[model samples]
Target: MIRGMAHHVGIYTRQSEQRASKSEASTETQWDDCVSGLPHWGLEPQHIERYEDLGISAFKDVDRPDYRRLLADAGAGRINVIVVHYMSRFSRRTAQETYDDLSPLLRNGVRLISVGEGREFHANNLFALFELLFKLQASHEESLNKSLAVRAAKDLEARLGGYTGKAPFGFTLVRETRRTDSGKPVSVKILTPDTEHEAPIVRRIAELADNWITENDPTGSVWKIARTLEKEGHKTRGQRMAKARGDARWDDKTVKRVLADPRIAGFDVESVYGTRKDGTRSTTVAEYRLVRRADGSPVQRYTPIIPAEQWYWIQGWLSDRHPGGNPHWDGKPSGLLSAMKLLFCECGATMTHGGSGFKKHYRCRRRAIKPGQHEGEVTIGAKGIEQHLARRIFAVMRAADDESALAVLAEAANRYAVQRERTVALEVTQERDRLLSERARLRRSREAHHADRERVMLKGGFVDDFARESWGETEQALAERMRSIDARIAEIGDSKAVGLPYEVWLTADTDPTGPGSWWDSADFQTKRAFFRLFFDRVSVSKARRWAGRGFPVETRVTIEWAGGVDLSDRPMVGVA
Candidate 1:
């Protein structure tokens, strides 16, 4: 501390190895320089507190923990002087951030000193403050230029079919030896397939994807494939798995990424970068082209996991499964109970499709003693059960043309409206109120600043122009935030009015033939929509019947209608 009022000195230093040269001073050297200079400023060795941020970029206004604590200590009057090796070490962010950080310290009677620059920042030193801001702006521009250069280099490397950054999954980097002009050995890094363990797993995953397409197995979805891999004790390979905090089990996303990667099909892909409205860029695979040698011949970079034909076939299948695709038919219902969630067994396990096409049936998936071993369970044939349920459902729809069904439908619509209000509208209202409150607070702060502008200019330490500019920026930011909040509220309101059941039901009812006919002629998605709209639940139970002296198991289907009607005793025979 220089005087009695200045009792503690905070030393702030930062070094980013990524952004700085190898010859640059480390955090330790910065700390030693600041410590040695503290005594000259009348601050004692015991009063000096060091704050260092290692490997953190100075151009970003991210939450640097020690830097934040240093500010807190200064604001709380625990520290009167802040020391740094240089102003750039303190911050290389935009001029606005530097102003925002140092303004409050100057106002609170704290001094910031830079040992390298041989200067102290105070209210009277306007020239030094401007110089510091100019340096910060220069640093910001330098960072931007460096970023552009790096991106250009990456683009060039990608076009040349060279791997950028880390080698992707299923590939390992190795140095290939080559001779230079002087006949000395040189090494060049190149990617090769990992054959030890990961290559086989990659091949297996590709085979599973191909089988799903060739055999038309909807049950072998991405999620199912991930589960099968986990059951077989397979794990994902990568640095992410090594550093993961939780159980790093294989997931549907991981499996999907591996399957979709073009490199596995022996092609080199170029990444496409798109800039968002916020000025941030995102990279995604643009196209997969065959790798070529210098002689313009195709190069086989790695052994293809799956044939290219099979990979494209799988891609077509995946595209058809997406919403708005050809849903009327893709192939036979991949399973009898493909998307039905209402079917459950007596053992309390949701029934899943078993067996291949035509012979497919729903069976309980619960395990018995061992993990892979399943217990004795009920099974119902797909075609027979669907036929039985369709007839019953058609009868129910015919009966629902009465006044009672209208009343029930009206009640359900009202419940839906109430639920929408509680969930969507309520959230919009709460967020709008919060934003309005913040806007009001900002207005108050602006008014106060205007009322005390003269007093601040005279003794508040900040230059008058900077003070006014910061206040204006703050006002603009608050106004933009409020506009965004308003836009969100309007969007929520519009969404709430769009999806009412009454509107759709009215249109469906006014159709030419009859309600049942319209439902029957509808597409797969429309039929599914009607099913969800009319039925609350469908459960199945096993019943024993004597068929020519042998006891044959039959499945009893129970349908609980959404309009308060319960239909049971619908029997499908010879299923189990």
Candidate 2:
């Protein structure tokens, strides 16, 4: 404000962190102080603009919107004076950054004022300018010291296995109160599983991810995983608590980021800086790297949902699936069996996506010179056929999980154990669990063999004949062991035992969506992959009429189920 002159004044206020009680007195107090002190300067403000940014830090990394707008207004001469309660309120960034922001206002002849600091600084005031720079330097140092103290405290808490920050997905914070040295009660929070709801979601996601690597089931996509979660009515951590920012629902990138977090494996993280190609430490910024010991092994603080091996592999998998890399699944549904080219017409022509929206269907384009040869073109409603296939696949999965079906023979051995093995001539203890347990043990053992390969690569990427011969022999032993396990697995569900059991890919029963409920929750890519597992090809006859809603899909779609052995060719056990 200038004596006996009217000026356009701008007031700016900000709050770094929101209060838990929902009261925002900090910004209001600053506004009140700035407004009350205006009369002391003997200035009448004709035009006024108030700028504010809440829950944003005045740092290099964070973008402050209102702050930027205020700067622009000052530069354009819209503000004759800019008022703040304190110098730090304008910025706590480094001296250089603080100078850059303030220089524009001073150059434009805008008077700068800090109501609390009792300092008057402008372009003409050289001593005051240096004084302000020194103040900015002090402010930055103070912020840096505070940040370091917070990090040190967090490190100490982590060492004591004390949980800090909001509990991530699949976990809940359990509070326990204890008396401190001075006899004051202090509440401590422990990260614990949300067993009934959240924990199982994580295991289910793990099972889906594990399928591609272990069962050779299908390539899983984070997009599809997100879609499945959406369909199953699973709210994100933010949406559940209702303090969330950004996405309103689950998304592919969000899913990937959540899975990549080390917290899922019960580990905390420390900020790690990257090194340049010349081997010098770069000053870009520190990234959150999973906390590891001096020996380079991960450290765990809580019970982990994933085994260390599986979790590490998942990290590798996600890295491969990053943008512009080789993805497990491209996050598109690819339209039923179209990607596989398994849907065919009666005349043997391949079917493809046609029509639009509700009228959308799979149509076989008429081909060949003679029109009669490609007569009665097949067109099946895509949604109806897809829904029907979903039911059939889930029904097969349902049969596998049914305990009653496993009583005489366990085609359902993986689901429910029928102590009786139909193919076993003599009594045997190796049921599905034992067989699977052994297979898992063999796989773990097989991982050790990879060290031999790694050693060769490190030693100039050449495998000598002698080393190859030794490795071959070692692999043969493991292969032979694996063959025995496979043979036992083959015997688990012989034709004489019962109908075929569709191996549950994702452990259906334990899922919150319930037994065999994955079909309803699956994304396009996932459903398409499962379709290939159960079907050789699906053919459709010519539609007699437009098979609209409520039409029976079975009458048009014919399925050829994939199997190791044709059921019709085998004999039953209980023949008189």
Indicate which candidate wins on lDDT.
Answer: 2
Taking the candidates one at a time, how many backbone clashes does each contain? 1, 0
Query: Which runs in model 1 stand beyond 4 Å of their true positions?
Result: 1-6, 9-42, 45-56, 60-78, 95-97, 114-120, 124-131, 163-166, 172-201, 204-256, 260-263, 266-576
Candidate 1, 378-414: lDDT as tens digits: 6777766655554444444344555544543543443
Identify the leading candidate in terms of TM-score. 2
Clashing pairs in 1: 1-43
Off by over 4 Å in 2: 1-6, 18-44, 53-55, 59-72, 93-109, 115-145, 162-167, 172-197, 207-220, 244-247, 267-298, 309-576
Assess candidate 2 and give its TM-score to the true structure. 0.44
Weakest ten-residue segment in model 1 by summed lDDT:
567-576
Worst 10 residues of 2 by lDDT: 414-423
CA-RMSD of model 2: 19.7
